[model samples]
Target: MAKHNIYKMSVSEVYPHYITKAEKKGRTKEEVDEIIIWLTGYTQAQLDKELEKKTDFETFFVNAPNMNPARTLIKGVICGIRVEDIEEPIMKEIRYLDKLVDELAKGKSMDKILRK
Candidate 1:
């Protein structure tokens, strides 16, 4: 099977979309950043650097400082697929982020979104 093109797409390319999805629902960029930080364990500065460098999603995850163990608790549907059921590890990680953003846009409390 062919690798999903999303893996090669720059995180910067999709970052704006995540912010836009959140903002349209009255959420803030900082909240989105917080979710990302919680999931990837990237310090704010490191995240900024990755965005500035236009890192691809696969590399971004691969080089994550500390992928939160709690991310395994993220269970939901995204893009019509159950995140917890995804078989590909990288794809699962991507969908986990997507699910979190979806939850945020749907007005879930940050504590719950973070699975705290």
Candidate 2:
């Protein structure tokens, strides 16, 4: 199988889809933003700026203000792959965010989603 070029994909392009998924499931965009902030430690303002800049995923993650150390505790399957088992660090981080969003859309409590 061919590898995906996720690094070349813009976070801006993907973020709105995440919001839509949450909203369709009766979750708010603010909730989506909150989970993102929790995972990446990016303030709302910084996240907005990155979205406006249309930076690729690689740059967006690389420039994150602070990655929460507790994020390693996030464990689950995403796209049939266990996030904790992902070999690539960047892919693992991206999957961690995906899993958090999945939990949010599934109406998991914010405390639980944040792994409290």
Candidate 3:
């Protein structure tokens, strides 16, 4: 199968959209960052560095310090597809982040959103 163009797109390219989506609903950038950190185990500084370096989605996830095992628990429909049902590894990881940001924007509390 052909890889989606998004795989090559830099995380920095889509990051602002995530922040805007959250902020439009009164959520903070910190919350979005928290979600990313939880999923990929990137320190705030490391995440920032990746963003500054324009790391593509594939590379960003490939280099994740410690992808949370709990991320498999993130189950739901995002972009009309079930995240857990995605068979492609990189795409699933991308959708997992999307789902978390969606939950935060919809006003789910941090604890529940974090699945704690």
Candidate 4:
């Protein structure tokens, strides 16, 4: 059996209210999961932690240790959890910086495009 971030068997047997591009496009949950895994590099637990912090729509520029400032954070309610978006140009720069740390960890990088 393979591991999954959003749909770990331990979490639940069903994902309610979760709407994703994958879902909209009629992609399998596993396929969508792959894209998420590719970007977040989260090993289930870590992903859950980030997901836990999100509870509403909030945008900000984050500059932590070893990070470049100018990233736009777009986090909001998605299937009830807070999902972050960093697709804005400002955030892309931050994503690039984070990616520099480890090319393999780009999956978890914050660089989601804002829907609005």
- Clashing pairs for model 1 are none
RMSD to native for every prediction? 0.6, 1.6, 0.6, 13.6
Give Cα-based local distance difference scores for all models: 0.96, 0.90, 0.96, 0.32
TM-score (all chains, Cα) for each model: 0.98, 0.95, 0.98, 0.31
Q: For residues 1-116, what per-residue lDDT tens digits would candidate 1 score against the true structure?
A: 99999999999999999999999999999999999999999999999999999999999999999999999999878999999899999999999999999999999999999999
In model 2, which runs have C-alpha deviations exceeding 4 angstroms? 1-3
**Colliding residue pairs in candidate 4:** 38-107, 39-107, 39-108, 40-107, 40-108, 86-111, 86-112, 87-111, 87-112, 87-113
1-116 in candidate 3: lDDT tens per residue? 79999999999999999999999999999999999999999999999999999999999999999999988889999999999889999999999999999999999999998889
**Candidate 2 lDDT, tens digit per residue, 13-58?**
9999999999999999999999989889999999999999998888
- lDDT string for model 4 (1-116, tens) is 44223222221222222224335545444443333334334445543444464411111112111222222243343334333443344334323323322221323322332111
The 10 consecutive residues of candidate 3 with the worst lDDT sum are 67-76
